[model samples]
Target: MAHAFDGKVAAITGAASGIGLATTEALIAAGARVVLVDRDSKALDAVCARLGANAIPLVIDLLDPASCNTLLDGILSKAGQLDIFHANAGTYIGGDLSETTPETIDRMLNLNVNAVMKNVYTVMPHMIERGTGDIIVTSSVAGHSAIPWEPVYSASKWAMTCFVQTMRRQLNKKGIRVGSVSPGPVISALLADWPEENLRKAKESGSLIEPKEVADGIMFMLSRPRNVTIRDMVILPSNFDI
Candidate 1:
């Protein structure tokens, strides 16, 4: 009856909803104690209550450098050690580049790029010192290609995709596994603001995936034996065209 993640501790950002929340549930089901990190206190509370005692809700904004410090400190203080870190917190801004405001650009880059870098930076030492850990970043299909519709978003994900790839090699000798899951489109808040026509088309064509499906991909990567590292996985809806 033993599970692959039994006795392990995981901290996931953006855990209040979407892929993050689904991953938390999957981890907990696999016997891992999870710390749900998100910026929404009320949503975090509701999710934790629904998830029961195994889920610990921690509301910390990933955009703030100090919050990253607080998150790591709080995780250690509460869970003692972190065996997995899912740097899945991110924001998306979709549209023509010319129409995007400078402030919006800054916000997207800060949350999608800077925040991810800071979280990994804050957690790497701990994982390295312990000589054991897994880091899975939620990237996007956009990262692997130049998406004209989401130029800035694609740039952010491209940065993460490269970062994860480089870190995997850099940390391999240190015993930490680094990887990324690039999903095409999922039924989550990330798509809530998508252009109506595009959203409708995706829905009608059944080209959107579920959060749990992406969670399953994450678990597959994490469940691999220590000697086996699934470096990168691009998961997309079977019927997705782009």
Candidate 2:
């Protein structure tokens, strides 16, 4: 059967593992050509080899702002046009605000916040020129509410949530859609890094969602009609309290 995204081109950041990797698989299955962007060249190459020809792995450090433009150029150079840009690359800083060093804080902000903005900026003009594009970000439920244990991570997601909402309003008339998938407690590298106790509790309770589930939500958002934009979809496990 034919899929809705047949022949579409997508670029996803942090595609080496977790939600990003799951989303890459989902897009490729839907018949879209995907550019899998991640800093881990070895893992990325292995994944691309597994995913086959539909997947193109581009290893670049998103923390370097210039890499954003480089990523855009690479996508255009390879695919000629980009239809979807999933700015789903993010890091989690788990702990009290005081426990985080300035360097750690900077790195988290750069990857989770600054890099997102730069990627959108690099791709927006191209999408605007074409008068069609979709930008889906992977935010967190913590962005919609306070998470005392993850103050820095929450702040970074909140920034992303706001950016997605604002950009939707700014670009809707240009035929571009901006939205986010805010998931709670997915079984990804980020969640695996949580304090051992919390990870164990969530796992024991089956309170963590899978990366593939979040990717499904992203595919639904992308498959929507051009006039229909899912501004935000908050996905959570049924047993999740927050």
Candidate 3:
């Protein structure tokens, strides 16, 4: 019962928790050696220990633009080569635009949009040289449709959606596949920014999906045949609404 990703090398950002953590676990279970990238060293170490040898913990603060290059370099230096990459590191900023401070806005955009673009750019040459790889970015339903509550977060995701689409066309011809996983509300730390009332309502209504569900979609995208690319997967709990 061999899996498609068996023995593949994958590097996932924000790999200590939430969607990223879930995806790391899934990849490990599928027999891929995963590099866990996160700023939380303690949590990263804990995860590495929990998952055993297949999980390689790499502590990094991706907010620094230079770290994007460092991340790829470190992975190559340690793991030898990278077969898959998931730009799953991001933050959430809900509430009205006016309520967000300049610093908050900058942080959200840097992590959600800028870092993702830079990460993909930094990894492209390597994947291109190898002429085969898979890149998946974690987007959100808000990316597909503007959500009034979190304007900044929504804008960042929309930008990611565009980036993934354009990068796919740019890289596909070189044997690299690019795609995105856009999920609705999920149980994760990102929801901490949401209004408590809204969060409670979603939970009560069973509208919030679990992080593992989103990870499952990512697994599906990665498992697709080399000749086929799952361009974008918008996974939402059946009862969840925009």
Give the alpha-carbon lDDT of every model: 0.92, 0.92, 0.91
**lDDT tens per residue, model 2, 1-242:** 14868979999999999999999999988889999999899998899999999899888898876666698889888788999999999999989989889999999999999999899999999999999999999999999999998999999999998999999999999999999999999988887568899899988998999999999999889998899999999999999997
Alpha-carbon TM-score of each model against the true structure? 0.97, 0.98, 0.98
lDDT of 1 by residue, 1-242 (tens): 23878899999999999999999999998889999999899999999999898899888987777776688898888788999999998888899999799999999999888888888888999999999999999999999999998999999999998999999999999999999999999998989769989999999998999999999999999998899999889999999877
Which residue runs of candidate 1 sit more than 4 Å off their true CA positions? none
